[model samples]
Target: MSLPPPPGTTASGGVPLSRRSLAPDLSRGVMLLVIAIVHAHIFQEMVGGDPQAPGAAFDAATTVFVMTFAEGRGYPMFAALFGYGLARIHLRRVAEGQPWPRVRSLVRRRGRWLVLIGVLHTVLLFFGDIIAVYGLIALMFAGLLHVGDRRLLAHGFTWMALGTLVYAFLNTLPSFTDPAAGGGVLTGSPLADMVTRLFTWPVMTPMLLMTSVFPFAVGVWAARRRVMEEPGLHLGLLRRSAFAGIPVAVLGGLPYGLASAGLWETAGAAETALAWLHLLTGYAGGFGYAALIALLAVRLGDRRGPVVRALAATGQRSMTCYLLQSVGWSVLFAPYALGLASDLSELGSVLVGAAVWLATVVIADVMRRTGARGPAERLLRWGTYREPRSGSATVTAQARSGG
Candidate 1:
């Protein structure tokens, strides 16, 4: 299989950068770091004793931070980046004169790898594997690739609204019958729970799908419209989105965070309502965060900023870093590993996450200097292209030569 043009390489073999180049990648890396921190905190909370019960001061403080930062923002940020990546991939294919069918094939292949990684992640580590969700979304996106950017955006909002209604309706079911009946949250065996989660819990699978898909679709729309490319021109939209999203996120998010900590258990209806609000606010917050970062990247106009560059490197090898994160977390938190989850307070978990993030940034930076793609990324590329191992050397050489 032939390799696509290298970063900044045009279809005609020129080396001019695309308008969307660098910033989104760096942004995604930063988002991933946040995601890692959030996951660490959530895992800690899940394993830690009941937050409402008399608990250790450390645990209480940790839970508060996780509730405030990790749970509320991490996943949404990841979803937005997913959308952006989807859009970027499609745009790249179109520029290369590749048909949607080829892009679809590529997405399908990539999805398979994602599913494989997610399955491994779920079985051996955390059950909150998002790759499966991404894989499913990829299939849906394949068909939607033909839609214009406006149509994609419209459909995304439609799904978001419809998903919100569906989730709210589900949450309103009778107390005994509600899927979130036990502690007003879903919990059970992993495999069985996942099945129930996919079908019964509208909020779990459907909401996740909707949330993931819309941001991705919006990212695609942004790409097509060159919004990130022309950040200055889109400053008004960015500011408006941030302004509208941040406060709403804080309001909705705070309640949801409290509910998650068992603060609103007695007020079941209020808790349910907050859950719906959180969904909306979380998305808003994610968008707000992305907009602010994008604006900064544009203003700074420094692709080599330490933070920006670190994230960009991570994004370039995201698949590897993502899996590595899962492995690291598993080893740090799993029952068989350090068992840190059971012992860690929210704050402790955040510290662990920070350490993990720093480590990954360092590793990514090292890999970037060496011009080596992350291992998982290399394998995924090989799988997607059906290329032989020997081809890797050629690819690496080309990459090093600034292909």
Candidate 2:
């Protein structure tokens, strides 16, 4: 280990484990924008909207914009970040000589708890809760935590290709032709709603893990290189991904975006193919966005403004803010609650989502300023880090021996 962590650890060492780096935190900070934009649509109950005829020009435009940019992209980005964060923790612990079994056990336990949290989130709030999705993905792909970058890249691309193909092929199946696949209408009964969510959770949890697992693996791969940790050294890669990947993502996402915006039309196989196109390129978009943000961080990290500080704080407390988002959504849209989902347009929902995001950011910033860690983060650390850090142990032994 570089050095034993500074002393003054609580009985459980309630303190930062390692020096925080900027890139992972910053990338996570901005990732909420993509998440906010995309999820805002899910809460919108499209009561009477014609896909072919665009009655609301602005809403149609927004759809195209989201299609070209946001949808299908956010979760992948989060998956990558999840991998990156876990990898950082894993590497730090390994550096300190912790056994693999202990590490795996800790990670698995954390994942299980996250699944419970995600279940509660889905039952009470938005159906698109990804905490459970990522939790399972983390556990399913944990064995590949040490895979080298070359193999990881190869497997990631291969899975991306196969996943796209499989998604399209499945959509063409006879059973998939039914609109029942879309989603369930919100029924106000809390008990009835929980039952419905349970039925879907089994299917959804697996599908989410399956689609994002490869990306999560790739994230672990990136973590090994410390790519995000050292953006200055990896400027070329960051620049190339930013320039090349973003443009490709934009073009690839365009067809789906247009189709989503009611500006493009197709039927049967053609529509399915277009859907796959969006899903396919979304991986590139997610990677590109992270790269672009890394480049920004390296170049302008020193210029801390209120906006920058707020974003970084929010990113640091991402888990807390993520749950808080659902809290806002539940209060505003759930059938048992405000039920604005039935009345709001897609664009209107986006605005509300942005406001909610802003509120969380401010809250996170306040926590940062007050020397308080995010409550969820604090709990996670306490749960995952059951024993004191090896660094702490070393310091304790040294002091006891009068070194």
**Residue-pair clashes per candidate, as listed?**
3, 0
Q: How many backbone clashes does candidate 2 have?
A: 0
Over 1-403, each residue of candidate 1 has an lDDT whose tens digit, in order, gives: 2222224535432222223356566666777777788877766665655443234655555555555555646567666677656655656665667667766766776677766765655555445667767777876666665676567788888877777656655644675333235321223343554454344333344546766766767666666556665677788998887787766677777766665555546355775676677777777887777777777877877446666677778877776777778778767775545767667656677788878877888888788878777887666555555533555443343233322
Q: What are the Cα lDDT values of the candidates?
A: 0.64, 0.71
Give the Å shift of residue 349 in candidate 2: 1.8
* Model 2 C-alpha RMSD to native: 5.2
Model 2 ranges off by over 4 Å: 1-18, 45-55, 168-185, 387-403
Stretches > 4 Å off in candidate 1: 1-9, 12-20, 50-65, 165-207, 387-403
209-316 in candidate 2: lDDT tens per residue?
A: 656866787788777777887788899988998888788889988987786666887677888788788777788888899999899889875677788878888888
Q: Estimate each model's TM-score.
A: 0.79, 0.86
TM-score of 1: 0.79
- With a 3 Å backbone cut-off (N, CA, C), the pairs that clash in candidate 1 are 62-346, 62-347, 83-216
Tell how far residue 139 is off in model 1, in angstroms: 1.0
Candidate that would win on lDDT: 2
